[model samples]
Target: MKNKIKLCILLLFSLSISAQKSNKPSTFERYLQTKELVNVQLIDSSIRADLKYATTDNFAKTILYDTLFNIYAHPVAAEKLAKAQKYLKELNPELSLLVYDAVRPLSVQKKMYKVVQNTKYAAYVANPSRTGLHNYGMAIDLTICDNKGQPLDMGTSFDFFGRAAGINKEAELVAEGILTKQQVKNRNLLRKVMTRAGFLTIRGEWWHFNAVSLSEAKRLYKIIE
Candidate 1:
């Protein structure tokens, strides 16, 4: 009962913030506090973020998240992300894991699906009815970046909707000159740290890593609404 009251207060505060100045803290930041989510930086500061959905730079060509600036995740996922960051530092002290997206609300997922539902990219964006790993705060999309914060060339850019983005055909893509050997190496480096940290890589998206299986996620965590 007390928690419910606190949640209502936070929601009101978030709504108030949303109506205020653009430079002020956002509603999503306040809303995140209403949940059991953790800010990834609190677990590990070295992991950098370039949350695509927060900006208009995503495939949707729109700002999916109105004012979501920081990356947040379930505590379980956050710990593994921190472990990945530790492994990344050990592998290449000059490089760090740069996050592209993290825990997303189901409301945002619906908006994202609306943008791609009629296109070939629909499969890539999970239907909100079925829910997605990000909705469960168990999936991450990221890449490796240098000390200067320049992302390594992974052949296709982040959120590229094509065969080149698929992890299953690296050798074939390379042989066909669609992806270079160096690009594959850069991708492998990212996979190395994430896999070592217990994240599972899906075949269709090289940049995506799951903290656990969908079934396990359903059993353990509630989707963020």
Candidate 2:
């Protein structure tokens, strides 16, 4: 009887430790496994890149981008992006900027920028896992056109977050009035096109869109590398 009681106590102790450990973040929590991704290249930049930033512990701020600076998105998110691009072209045939960053290759550096910073929130670090959506390769980040094919203003820079980064908030310095009321209309036009192609937008950030449908919620992944 004493041995059985001791065994029960030991089991409880083990379970308690596991629960505590689970609360702490680990690299494995932020990376996906090889079986969970689909590999493809959808970005049309100088270097096709795709990778997102996140930590194994928490997901307060997730930053997805191409392999280079000022790029974002993954290749798996291409369908909607293509739709948006086509619609944008229709709005302005002269717009000739190409898609740059999508999914990042693991060989590159991994770091998630704090899109929005506050005392309440902590930034996430990058963990390259074979299981991440970028591994499947379909997301993308886009820039606007300079005569030389550079990105233009939406509000904040590519991965910026804050009141100034608000999709609806107007910032003269960052956006250069690019996302004005008319610009929002133009953006909405692109949004409509993407929605038709199966993408959904979040209210807080104008640049963010998700391709997962309600039915595919289970498939929406949350793995650590």
Give the C-alpha miss distance for residue 224 in model 1, angstroms. 0.2
Could you give the C-alpha RMSD of every candidate to the true structure, in order shown?
7.8, 15.0
Per-residue accuracy of model 1 over 180-218 as CA lDDT, tens digit each: 999999999999999999999998889999999999999
Question: Native-vs-model 2 lDDT?
Answer: 0.44
Give one digit per residue, the lDDT tens place, for model 2 in 85-161: 56656767655334433444443323432332443433422344423333333334444454455445454454455
Candidate 1 has which clashing residue pairs, if any? none
State TM-scores per candidate: 0.86, 0.46
User: Largest lDDT belongs to which candidate?
Assistant: 1
Query: Global CA lDDT of candidate 1, please?
Result: 0.88
- Candidate 1: which stretches are off by over 4 Å? 1-25, 117-120
After aligning candidate 1 to the native by TM-score, how far in Å is the CA of 130 from where it should be? 0.9
Query: Ten-residue segment with the worst summed lDDT in candidate 2?
Result: 48-57
TM-score of 1: 0.86
